[model samples]
Target: MGIGDKRKSDAERQERRRQRLAVDGIKPMTVHFPDQDRSIVRDLSRRVLDGQSIRQVMRELGGSNQPDGNVVPPEVLAELDYVKARLVAIEREAASQLAEIEEAERQRRTLEAERDVARVAEAEERAKVHTTATEAQAATRAAQEAKERTTEALQRAEKAETAIRRARSLPGVRGRLVRWLAGDVLPD
Candidate 1:
């Protein structure tokens, strides 16, 4: 067959395959064409329907396969790459700041716990001191009561000695009786 006849035969076979796939409930693949030329668009469509990937189709059409590469100029691509890098740097800085903030918060909580423990210890110490002071006050009060009792007993003993001396000086009181009253030794 001639080249044109072979191409026509291939196209007929492709159309029959597409019809069979559609009847079997299978969807046909599609591709986007940017050119306004009817022949080029039809060719790209046929390539896509023939199971060619979008990347292959784009490369075959002399278009960039990278996303947005064809639509954007070289200067725009450079700017976009710079912006993406800047965005990544900013994200990393934000993460670092977040970690620092979390660490600071943890330290603050630890310090607060330490302060609470110190405060509890101080309160316990104050309670102990208060209890000690109460006990000391009670002991001091008991000591003062004992001292007052001893002072009263001493005063009474002095009065009794004075009465005995007065009685001994009377005419009827014998020396022996005076000695007995004074709790002294008597001669035989």
Candidate 2:
């Protein structure tokens, strides 16, 4: 095999070894450190090599198995529970009130929208009524003017009929009336 093929076979062999170790509760890891922390990495690696896992070293550094003077008392914990319950109740009440306010606002907006629609409808009705009233008034005026013209014409016709009767009663006017008005010669 070539050099590249040999290296690939070596990596596969190492991976199989890692899997076998993991099944026996032993896992391998790579640790990295900054150039300035080389000393720290060396110390950490030395502890791991001594059969102490990283977690054990970290637990010892974290002050485990030591008396803690800052332990919270049961009384304080109970009071904290009460305070938390009170805070939750306050938050729930505030949320309920907010929801109610939102509902009322929505209802108010709906009422306003309904009023706007009603106003538009009323305005349309008023326009229709006003137009009808104007048309009716115009028709009444036309009818009245026609009646007055007919009355005047009838009065003038009555006056002319009376004047004709008066002229015919005169002696010679009747004889001339047949010639001038009727265009006929007078018979004996």
Candidate 3:
């Protein structure tokens, strides 16, 4: 009816109207495809409502066959590609850091094991020294006891010798002591 509305009853008239619509500056409303970040899709129904040419809009945005082989707006599709590349780089960095952390943990465990071994060795050495000192102390006590016994024996022997000498110095005590020692009774 008007310059924008080009609805025709006949097929030929519709074709002519479509061509005229393409020449006009009318375009479909753009819709952002959340699933596809790098591209957007122009709504053909909205284009018809706005008295615009759906074919022209489809052709302008790569004819609905995007570079990625999908009917998506070029803008959002490019953004998605960029996001994918960034995510790959981030994953690579994370993997590297994880490897480093694993290595560091391994080294720490190794050092701890070594330290435990050293501690055990040192403790064993200390135990050995303690045992040796105990043995030495016991030996020293035994030697001291033996020396005391020998001294007591010598003192007893010396006392018996002195008693024998005193008896000999007496007049008849020597003969009487000898008779008693021989198990024979002496005259009073």
Candidate 4:
């Protein structure tokens, strides 16, 4: 291809790569460094991806300059420090919130356990009350049966006493015979 066409093709390829990276949610680093220090910056980016703290990565990088003696700008270093502080603060806040959520969950579980115990106890008490009521009903029925039996016996005894009195009032041989058999003395 001609030189101009090659350049145009390379630009198009770079643009496509950038678009693909963006779509994949991989943000390109905005920090500019000397060409000779690109390897170090790439290493730092790798450490960040590996979940190292920003402060730790910065410490590892140290304040070393490029082989060409090109030091990072003072303003950029200051900005890095500021960003690291903000990240630390945000992490601390997240930890605090996580601790609070765990505490709330523990309390909720405890309350649920207590509520379950109360429900079980309430059911037990209801069972006891139902048993007591059943026993009372049974007792009432037994008492009624006993009273009915006693009343019937008393009625039979009264009828027997009336028959005995009527038999004693009869006057004749049969009455005399009945009195003798009943262990009553006969009248002269």
On lDDT, the candidate that comes out on top is 4
List where candidate 2 sits over 4 angstroms from the true fold.
1-70, 163-188
TM-score of structure candidate 2: 0.50
Reference-based TM-score, model 4: 0.52
Better of 2 and 4 by TM-score: 4
Clashing residue pairs in candidate 1, if any? none
lDDT of each: 0.82, 0.79, 0.72, 0.83
Angstrom error of the Cα, residue 89, model 1: value is 1.9
Candidate 1 wrong stretches, greater than 4 Å: 1-49, 52-76, 162-178, 184-188
User: Can you give the TM-score per candidate against the true fold?
Assistant: 0.53, 0.50, 0.52, 0.52
Name the lDDT value of residue 39 in candidate 3. 40
How many residue pairs clash in each candidate at the backbone level?
0, 0, 10, 0
Better of 3 and 4 by lDDT: 4
Overall local distance difference test of candidate 2:
0.79
Model 4 alpha-carbon drift over 4 Å, by segment:
1-72, 172-188
